[model samples]
Target: MVAPRDNWVVDGLGATHEFDRLHAVEHRHHHDGGGGELHARGRTIRDVADVLCAAPLDPRIVAAIRACHALGCDLRILSDANRFFIDAVLDHHGLRGYFSEVTTSLSRVDADGRLRIAPYHDFHAGTHGCCLGTCPRNMCKGQALDRIRASTAAATGGKKQRLIYLGDGRGDYCPSLRLEREDLMMPRKGFPVWNLI
Candidate 1:
């Protein structure tokens, strides 16, 4: 539930920061919105690609993701960055290979009720629309975690595995709230959710 932060929603043109609702993306040319306006600046697939390609990769997180893979934990990624943008970031960081599954709000449905796969970053372009009710924020972490539970049941013949989630933002609060009493959660450098527990 990593909400866009810092450069995540730079200059706030067509971005929203909520986890359960559309933040109502307003273009810079539009009249009103919060957090900022969605400027066409750095909003292109190519533009974002260059930035991600140049951004420094977080080695610690990378190692954590890799360790999850090595331990046979199903590693999945859910992000608000349209699938293409997320992929570009991952691809740039060389972390794409670490995730077992990736889901984003960029899925598009056509008139024929078929899915139209657009590049993750170009999803905001005209001639197409974002997937209906496809906001990653619409996906509650508990629900996503439930799917993981089901998969584990199928994989291990009904054996239950402990789940530990680490996050650092307001959106993460909901998912963290759903964690088992013994499960672990934390805010990067802010404060400990456990302290509140």
Candidate 2:
């Protein structure tokens, strides 16, 4: 018999709790927490995974990502989504191997023992301030991209490599701006962030 569908992410707090529970279980099974994701995206990991699996993924996009991986280019995912969910989605689409690393905010914690979403002033001024705010882990896309660049540089004998980022949301803005000429940034159609740069 088919099991009943579980909806763990009934609310924001429920989502967070779900992530924490999964992480705890995974930690016990692996017996090594260091190798897993550092940023936590929600309260529970499975809740995040459920949402991703329920969503429809584009096969063409998956193929493109796989092609990039075949070219010896690393496919790294930096998103606010919880690590478990994101990773599961990739695996479900047979694209897990494409990504060299995956970073999610659900894996990191702040000094206050909560998610660390950076508080940065907008380009305008104090009046138009915007904070990424506290996420599940310190796993903001900008920060993850920064970490990826540094790690790649270290691994590739300090060679500066190009970056390609794509997103359909406001969260993609800050990270895209950080890319250089060699890098590529793609945003969804009608997103104001795309026009700003």
lDDT top scorer? 2
Cα error, candidate 1, residue 84 (Å): 1.9
* Candidate 1 local lDDT, 1-197, one digit each (tens): 23233244332323444311333342221111211222222244344356545555557877777787898876666443445456766776667777777755453333533323333233234312223322223344455555666886798898766767766544355566667776666556654433333
Whole-model alpha-carbon lDDT for candidate 2: 0.52
lDDT of 1: 0.49
**lDDT of each candidate versus the true structure:** 0.49, 0.52
TM agreement with the true structure for every prediction: 0.59, 0.59
Candidate 1 residue pairs in clash (backbone atoms < 3 Å): 12-37, 13-37, 13-38, 13-39, 14-38, 84-120
For residue 111, give model 1's deviation from the true position in Å.
16
Candidate 2 lDDT, tens digit per residue, 99-188? 777665333444534432222222123322225433222234566577789989999999989777777555667777678889888776
